[model samples]
Target chain A: QQQVKQSPQSLIVQKGGISIINCAYENTAFDYFPWYQQFPGKGPALLIAIRPDVSEKKEGRFTISFNKSAKQFSLHIMDSQPGDSATYFCAATENSGYSTLTFGKGTMLLVSP
Target chain B: DAGVTQSPTHLIKTRGQQVTLRCSPKSGHDTVSWYQQALGQGPQFIFQYYEEEERQRGNFPDRFSGHQFPNYSSELNVNALLLGDSALYLCASSLTPGKPQHFGDGTRLSIL
Candidate 1:
């Protein structure tokens, strides 16, 4: 079973536009949610993360909005740039035991000039 | 201050052969985790190691095994490789099992 589900396998947006990616989780025990950005030929880098206690967390151009009751979270990039084009993955962890993170299928975002 | 490092960035093997990949964790990190990513798919967890012991594992086969050394470096060995085993093998390091993980560039393994 896929613990996490992501929408819009691929997305394209104009420069300076807002880019959005959505994700939902099946495990209510998940407490940590993190997003990662990966470029070609490189490893994934941490972008932004949010815990269950917070409804929203923002860092510069990246923001993560989470809904606890709905078990959903979304990542919004403000002023999206061409360099922001990459694959994004959303993951969740239960915060106990071994803390294995269940990831969703990545969403490829392309920003045009 | 070095990040996670994986060796043999690329490799090719035929069916029934075996392959091994290595990883060195970042400075001060003691935990290592392995993941397998196929084309257009998210990474699937293989297993994790800490203190030279296997801590947790995912739903994989017995053909996949690993070893962690005293220095905290790790190795992944696959026996009797098959065509379906071709994928990018990634190694991640973290201070603890539940914390943010730092990843390496990964080793691409192609099985014919």
Candidate 2:
């Protein structure tokens, strides 16, 4: 019940296109959802985040579409560029408790120019 | 303000050896969390420290322990290590609970 399941282990998208990655979670205690982006040999960086109260949140060209009822969430990158190619991870954390994050396996997105 | 910073960048150890990784949290941040990221896998929570005490821990064994100083610096110690322990150790810091965390480059541990 603490795991976040992310899909599309790897994806290839063309430049100026849209890239999407999906994640489903099992733990209902989670109230916070976030997406992270990582380049080679670098730590994961916070891309965007959302809460159960809101269905969607956008930052720049990145957006998080959340489904509280379905326990699912996804990340959409508009105008995907080569620099956007990186490993993306979806994660969740409960409002209370230790505030530890539960992360999915990860998705490697490759944008071809 | 400086973000989370980890020391040694990389380390190598053999079986039965012990390793210690250090972390300096971002300025004005009081919480520090440690994670282990195996190849092709996302970072897994190890533990968290606040106010110089370990507030929470994950599923790791007792061989994995930690300490936090009054200055908000933290250390992760792994004893009796095995080859399977090889992975990237990441340090993340946040200003408040439920807020986004900032990560350091990470310390790569290679066990032989």
Candidate 3:
């Protein structure tokens, strides 16, 4: 079973527009939610993360909005740029970041110049 | 400081052969974790090593094994390889078992 489910397998957005991706989880044991960005032929890089205690966390133009009660979270990128085009993955883990990660399939985002 | 580094960036093997991949963790890191990522799919955890011992494992089989040296470097060994084993193997390291992990470019293994 896929513990974490992500939506919009792929997305396309214009430069400077808002880009959003959604995810839902079934395991209440999950307390840490992290987003990763991966370019082709490279490893996934940490982007932003949030814990159940917070409803939202923002860094630069990337933001993660988490809902513990609803078991859902979303990533919103403000003013998307061409450089932002890449594959994004949302992952969840237990034991406060000490455990193995359960990842969603991933979303391929494209920002048109 | 150097980030996680993996050796033998690419390899090709036929079925029934065995292969070993190596990894050197980032500076000051002591824990190593391995993952397998198939084409067009997200990476799946293989196992993790800390203090020269296997601390956690995913749902992989015995064919997949690993070792951690005292210096914090790690190696992944696969025995009786199959075509289905073809994938990009990743190595991630953290200062401790629970800290944020830094990943390497990964070793691409193709089985014929």
Candidate 4:
């Protein structure tokens, strides 16, 4: 069972355009939602994170819009640049001390300059 | 200051062999977790260690085992390697078990 499901396995956007990726989760126990960016041959880096208490959280050009009732969340990147071309992963985990993350397959985004 | 450091960066093993991978956590972190990432897929959790004990584990087989030292560094061991075990093994560290984890570049393990 895939607890977290992400849409649009891949994406392409022009530089300076807005890029959006969506995710839906089946586990209601999940309280913390985070996004990670990974470049080829490297490890996944923490990008942005949000809690169920907030409907939205924005950090720089990256924004995470979360809907607790709907069990859904989305990531929006403003002014997408060529540097943003990489794989984005959405993950969820419970607030319990021993909880492990459940990750979405991933979305590969490409920004053309 | 060092986020997370994994050893060897790459390794190759044949079937029925055994391997060990190492990880050093961030300076102040105390928890270590292991993950396996197949090509073109997201990483899957293996297990986590805290206070030199296995606190939590994922659904991986018994073949995957780990150890956490007194310094918070960890090691992953796999016995009787199988071709299906070929993947990028990632190590992550956090201040606590459920806290935000920092990842290393990972060690690419290939099984023949």
Candidate 5:
């Protein structure tokens, strides 16, 4: 079962534009939501994460706006640049060891110069 | 310190063959989990090992198994490989149960 669902399988934006990716989950037990960015040949790197307790978390150009009641969260990248063009994955995990993370299919974001 | 490290960045094997992939967790991390990512798909969990034992597993076949060593390093072994087994195998590490995980570059395995 796909515990989390993401929208816009792919995206393209102009430089300096706002890039948004949305995700929704059916499992309310999920407490930790994290976003990852992956290059073509590398692994996914942690971007920003938000716990259900918080409605929003921001770091630099990345922000996670979470809505606990709606079971949804979205990643926003401000001033999107060419470097920001990569695949983004939103994942949910409740606890640590022995547990698995539920991830969305991923969004391939391309920022044009 | 080095983050999670995986060996043999890329490999190719024939059907019916067996292969072993290895992973060394990041410094201060104690748990290891394995994931498989097919083309254009998100990663799927296989199993997780902590304290030298597999504590949880996903819906995979018996052919996929793993082990954790005393040093928190782990190995994933796939037996009787099939063409469908071709994918990128990833290893994620965390300090303990329920923490956010850090991932390795992954090993791309192609079955012929």
Candidate 6:
């Protein structure tokens, strides 16, 4: 079973526009949600994360909006830039146990200038 | 301090052969996790090691095993490799299990 599901296998956005990626999870046990960005020939890097306790968390131009009751979350990038083009993965894990992250299939985002 | 470091950026192995990939965690980190990422797919967790012991494991087979040394370095060994095993192997390190992990560039393994 895929614990987490992400939408839009691929997305194209104009530079300076808002880019959004959506994710829904099946396991209500999951309390931590994190997004990772991966570049070619590199490993995935932590982008932004949000805990279920907060409805929204923002850092700089990146924001994570979470809905616990809906078991859904979304990542919103403001002022998307060409440099932001990369594959994004949304993951979730139950905080009570070991940190085994269940990830989504991944979404490839392209921000064109 | 150096981030998570993995060796042998790439490797080629024939079916039925065996291979080992190594990883050194970032400074002061204590936990190491291994993941396998197939083409066009997100990473799949293999297992995690903490305090030189396997703490958590995913749904992979016994052919995939790992070890963690006192220095907080780890090794992943795959036995009787199959063509389907070809993928990018990634290593991530964190101060604690389940925290935000720092990843290495990864080792690309191709099975012939």
What tier of docking accuracy does candidate 5 attain?
A: medium
lDDT of 4 by residue, B55-109 (tens): 8899999999999999899999999999999999999999887789999999999
B20-101: candidate 6 lDDT, tens digit per residue: 9999999999999999999999999999999999999999999999999999999999999999999999999998886688
Deviating ranges (above 4 Å) for candidate 5? A96-98
Candidate 5 lDDT over B1-112, as tens digits, reads 9999999899999999999999999999999999998988788999999899998899899999999999999999999999999999999999886777899999999999
- DockQ (0 to 1) for model 2: 0.68
Query: Per-residue lDDT tens digits of candidate 5, residues A27-107?
Result: 878888999899998988889888888899999999999999999999999999999999999999875312578889999
**Model 6 whole-model lDDT (C-alpha atoms):** 0.94
Tens-place lDDT per residue, model 3, A50-93, is: 99999999999999999888899999999999999999999999
Best by DockQ: 3
Q: Can you tell me the DockQ of model 1?
A: 0.67
Interface RMSD of each: 1.8, 2.1, 0.7, 1.5, 2.0, 1.8
Write down the lDDT of every candidate, Cα atoms only: 0.93, 0.92, 0.95, 0.94, 0.92, 0.94
> For residues B1-112, could you state the per-residue lDDT of candidate 3 as single tens digits?
8999998999999999999999999999999999999988888999999999999999999999999999999999999999999999999999998788888999999999
In model 1, pairs of residues that clash are none
Quote the B-chain TM-score, candidate 1: 0.98
How well is each residue in A1-113 modelled by candidate 2, as lDDT tens digits?
Answer: 43889999999999999999999998889988889999999999988888898899999999999988898999999999999999999998997424799999999999999
Model 1 C-alpha lDDT versus the unseen true structure: 0.93
In terms of docking quality, how is candidate 2 classified? medium
RMSD of each: 1.0, 1.2, 0.7, 0.9, 1.2, 0.9
As for model 1, its CA RMSD to the true structure in angstroms is: 1.0
- Can you tell me which runs of candidate 3 are displaced by over 4 Å? none
Stretches of candidate 4 off by over 4 Å are A96-98
Interface DockQ of candidate 3: 0.83
Kindly report which residue pairs in candidate 4 clash with one another.
none
